[model samples]
Target chain A: MSDREVGGAAEAAAAVIPGSRAMLAVIARSLSPLHGQVTVPQFRILVILADSNVALRSGDLAKALDVHPSTLVRMADRLVARGLIRRSENSASRRETLIELEPAGLDVVRTVTRRRQRDLRRILERMTSGERAAFVDAMQSFTRAAAADADADLTSFGL
Target chain B: MSDREVGGAAEAAAAVIPGSRAMLAVIARSLSPLHGQVTVPQFRILVILADSNVALRSGDLAKALDVHPSTLVRMADRLVARGLIRRSENSASRRETLIELEPAGLDVVRTVTRRRQRDLRRILERMTSGERAAFVDAMQSFTRAAAADADADLTSFGL
Candidate 1:
C-alpha cells in the first residue's frame, strides 16, 4: 500500500480498536471461570500484585492502573471479599492498606495464564508470520501514541 | 526473548490496549470542534453508515455496537435533528428507519480520519523497525488469541 493508503488504513483500524476492546472485555469476563471466580479487573489487580515482590498499597495499585482511588477501593474490597487478597494495616504506615495476594490468588493466576496461553497458541497458529509481525507492530505504535495522547492531559478528565 | 517470554510481554502489553481504546473514546468525545455539536455516538453512526455503503436501520447499529435500541433511537434522533442523516420512509418496513450519511457527515469522517492518522504517525515513529516488527507480530497473536479465548469461554482474569 502507498503511504496515504497505509495511513488511511491505520486510521480505519484505529476506529475499530474501541469496539475490539469492548469485545476483549467480554473475553476477559468469560475467563472468570477458568480460575476461581473473579472479575477481570480484580484479576488484573492480582496479576500486578503477584508480579511485584513487595506488597502494594491500594494507592499504588490505583496509580498503576490509572484508576480512581475509589475504584481501587472497590476492587480491593471485592478481592478481599473473595479471599484472593488480604487487606490489613500497613506495618510502616498507619494510613495505608497493604494488599497481598494469597496462595489461592497465586494459583488462580497460574491457571488463568495457562488458559490464556493455550488460547493464544491456537490463535497464533492461524496467522502468517508476517501478518503477526505487522499486527503487533501496529498495536505497539497504537498503544504508545494513545499513552502519549493520554499523558498530554492527565487531569483533563476527572480520572 | 523466547516465545514464552515474548508471550508474557504480549499479555502485559495486551492489558494496555483497553486503556488505549478508552483514549480513543476520549478523542471521539473531542470531535465537537469538527462536529459543530454532534454527539460522539452520532458521529459513530455516521461513520458506520458511510463505511457500510448501504443504509442501516438504528437497530443494526445498536446491535453492532452492543448498545441498546433506545440508545440508537436517541442517537438517530440527534443525527436526524442535525440533518446529517435522513430517515427513509419505507413502505415495506415502517418500523425500520434506514439511515444514510449526508455530505456533512462525509466531511466529518474525512477530518476525523486525518486527525487519527496524525496520531498514528506519532506512535509509529517511536519504535525501531525490528522492535516494531516483533511488536506487530505479538499483537496479531494476542488479538487472535483474545478473540478465540472469548469464543472458547476462556477469561484472562486469573492472570
Candidate 2:
C-alpha cells in the first residue's frame, strides 16, 4: 500500500478507542463515588468474578481485561486485602492463582451493579426505544471494529 | 419515596455510567497510540480547548469536565510543560487565567479528528449508509443522555 493508504488503514484501525475513551470519562465521572470507596482495579476484579460462572485464573482475568498480568496481580492483592476476593494456587499450574469473589466481594458487586443498572435505565428512559436500540447496536459495532483493529490479539495481555 | 422505590430508582440512574465506561475502555484500547501518548485528563483538556471558540478559564474547564478547579490547574501545568497549551491572565478577571491550545495542541487535535473521521468511515463502510446515520444519531443521543444524567447535583464534589 502507498504511505497515505497505510496511514488511512492505521487510522481506520485505531479510531474507536479514543471515542470510547470520551464515553468512558462520563461513565467514570458518574461512578466516581465507587472509587472513593473502592479502587477501579479492585472493582474490575470483583465484576469479573461476580459475572463468571466459575472461578478463573489470574492469567485468564488479565487476558479478558486486556491488562498486564503484573497489573492483575497487584489488583488481586488489593482485592484480597479488602476481602473482596480470594486467591489460591492452581494445583495443575502452581505458578498460576485461581481467584473467586468472596461474600463481601459479591455484596460490593451487587451494590455497584444495582446502582449501574439504575443509571443505565434512566439514560435509556430519556431516549426513545429506537434510540436505545441504535445506541446498543453502535456500541456492538464499535467493539467489533476495535477488536478487529487490535488484530484479535489477546493472549499476551490475557484478554 | 419508599425504600424499595428509592433503591430501584438509584439503580436505574447508575447503570448507564458503567456501561458507557466499559464501552469507552473498548474504544480507548482500539485507539491505542493516542492514549498511549497522553493521559486521559490531558486529552480531555485538549479536546475542550479544541472545541472552544475562545480561550476558557480554569473554572469553566473544571465545570465542563466535572473536575476540581485545582485539578484543571495541575493539568494545565502539565500541558504547559508539554507545550501543547498555554494559559494567559484574563484582563477582565485578574484571578482568572484563560486556557488556549498552542499550535502543537491544535495539530494534535486535528490529527485525532482526522483519524476518528477515518475510523468512523471505515466502520460505517462495513454497514449500509442507513446504518451509519443511525450509528451517529445513536452516539449523539448517548452523549445527550449521559450529559443530562450528569446534571444531577455533583455539588458534593464542589463541581
Candidate 3:
C-alpha cells in the first residue's frame, strides 16, 4: 500500500478504538459479579466448557488455551476446589482425564452472558431503527472481512 | 424490563460480539512486534505519555494507571532503563518526579497505531459505501450510549 493509502487507513482505523474500548468495558463490567470468585482466565475455562457441552480432554483443553499441560492442571485444580469443574477419567483412554463444567460453572457463565445481553439491550435500544439496521449490516460485512484477514495469518506485515 | 424486551435486546446485542472480538484481535496483533520488548502495561504507559505530550507527574501517572505508587515506580524504573521513558525530579515541587515518554517510546506507539489503522482500512474498504456509512452511524450512536452507561456507573444492577 502507498504511504498515503496507509495514512488514510490509519485515520479510519483510529475511529474504531475509543468505541471498541467502551464496548469491551461493558462486557468486562458484566463479569464483575464473579469478582474474586473467578479470575478472567478461570472464567475463560468455564466459557470453553460451557461452549462445548461434552467434557474436554485435559490435553485438548491445554492446547485450546495455549497453556502448558501443567499450567492447565494448576488452573483446573482451583476450579475443582471451587466446585466449578469436575474431572473424570476418560472412558475412551485410561491415561486421559476430561474436564467438565459443573452446573455452578454453567450458571456463572449464563449469569455473565445475561448481564452482557442486558447492557447490550440497554445501549442498542437507544439507537434509531435505521441505525440498528445499519449496525447489523455493517457488522456482517466487517466480520466477513475480519475472518478472511484472520485466516490470511495476522503475523504478516510485522503484526 | 419485560422478559420479551430483554430477550429481544439480547438478540440484538449478540450481533456485535464476534465482530468486536475480530476487531480486538486485529488490535492485539498490532502489538506483536513489541512482544518481550515491552509488555502491554508498559505499552500503556507509553500510550498515556504519547497522548499527553508533556511529562506527567509520577504520582499522577500512578493514579491514572490505578496502580500503587510503588508499583508505578518499579514500572517506570524499567522504562527508564529501556530508555522508553525517563523520570526526572519535579523542579516546581521538591517531592514529585515526572515521567516522560522518550522519542523511542513515541515511535513504537506510532508504529502499532499505524498497523492497526491499516488493518482497519483494509477491512472497511471491503464493505460497500452504504455499509461504510451505516458503520460510522452505528458506531457514533453506540459510543454515545456507552458513554451514558459508563456515567451511570456499571456496578448498578449487578453490572
Candidate 4:
C-alpha cells in the first residue's frame, strides 16, 4: 500500500483496536500511589515476587523479566534498601541468592492490583454481560496470537 | 472484603478483562524496533505530533500528555537533538514555541504504527466478526470511562 493508504489503515485500526496508549494511561493512573515509591520495572519485580509461591533465584528472576542480571541486581538492591524485597542465601546452593517479596512489597502489589481491578470493574459494569464475554474471548485470541508470534521470534533466534 | 478475597477478585477480573499488562507486553513487542533509539515516552510524543494536523504549543502538548512542563521541555530537547521533532516559533505568539513532527519523525511514527496494526490485525484475523465488534464496543466504553476518570481527577486537582 502507498504511504497514505498505510497511514490511513493504521489510523483506522487504531480507532477500532484498544490502543495501548489508552490502556497505559488508565494503568498509570491506577498505579499513581506507587509513583515515587517504586519505578514501573521495580513494581513489576514486586508483582512477580508477590505472585510466586516460592522464592526465585536472582538469575531466574532476571531471566523471567528479560532484564540483565546486573540490572536486576541493582533493582534488587534498591528494593532491599526500601524493605520491599528480601534476598537470602539459597539453602540448596550456597553460591546463589534467592529473592522474595517482603510483606511491604506484597502489600504494595495488592494495593495497586486492587485499585486497578476496581477501576476496571467500574468500566466493565458499564457494559452488558454479552459485551464482556465477547471482549474476554477476543482478548484471549489476541493474547494467544501475540504469544505465538513471540515464541516464533524466540525460536528464530535459537533461544 | 478481606485481603485474600480482594486478591481473588482481582485475579478473577484479570482473567476476564483485557488486562493492561498483556496489552502493554504486546505493544512493547510490536515496538521493539524503536528500542535503544528512543524511549517509550519520546515515541508517545512522536505519535501525538504525528496525529495532530497542526503544530502544538509546549503547554498544550504537556496538557495532552498529562506531564509536567519541565519534563516535556526535557523530552522535547531530546527529540530535537535526535532530529525527530522540530520546535518552531509559534506564529501566533512569539513567547511560545510549537512542536511538530519532522519528516523523519513522521516516518518513525508511520513505521511503528504500521507494525502495531499488523500485529493487531494478525490477532484480529483469528477472531470472529462478532467478537471483533464486541471487542471494539467494549474498548470504546473502557476508553471513555478511563478518559472521564482522568478528567475528573484533573478537575479535582484544579489542573
In model 2, which regions exceed 4 Å deviation? A1-26, A60-69, A128-159, B1-26, B66-68, B137-159
Clashing pairs in 4: none
lDDT of 3 by residue, B52-95 (tens): 78999988778766679999989998988999998877889978
Q: What ranking emerges by TM-score with the best candidate at the front?
A: 3, 4, 2, 1
Off by over 4 Å in 1: A1-43, A103-112, A127-159, B1-55, B65-91, B98-120, B127-159
Show model 4 residue runs off by greater than 4 Å: A1-15, A18-21, A140-159, B1-19, B128-130, B144-159
Could you report the DockQ of all the candidates, in the order they appear? Answer: 0.14, 0.24, 0.39, 0.27
Output the number of the lDDT-best candidate: 3
Per-model chain B TM-scores are 0.62, 0.65, 0.84, 0.71
- Residues B69-136 of candidate 1 have per-residue lDDT tens digits of 99888877887787788778666889777877878777777676656545544554455545444544
lDDT of all predictions: 0.60, 0.63, 0.74, 0.69
Contacts from the true interface found in each model, as a fraction, amount to: 0.14, 0.26, 0.54, 0.28
Cα deviation of B10, candidate 1, in Å: 13
Which candidate comes out best when scored by TM-score? 3
| Interface RMSD (Å), every candidate | 7.7, 6.9, 5.8, 6.5
Q: Candidate 3: misplaced stretches above 4 Å? A: A1-11, A150-159, B1-10, B148-159
TM-score of 4: 0.79
Better of 1 and 4 by lDDT: 4
The candidate 3 chain A region of ten consecutive residues with least summed lDDT is A150-159
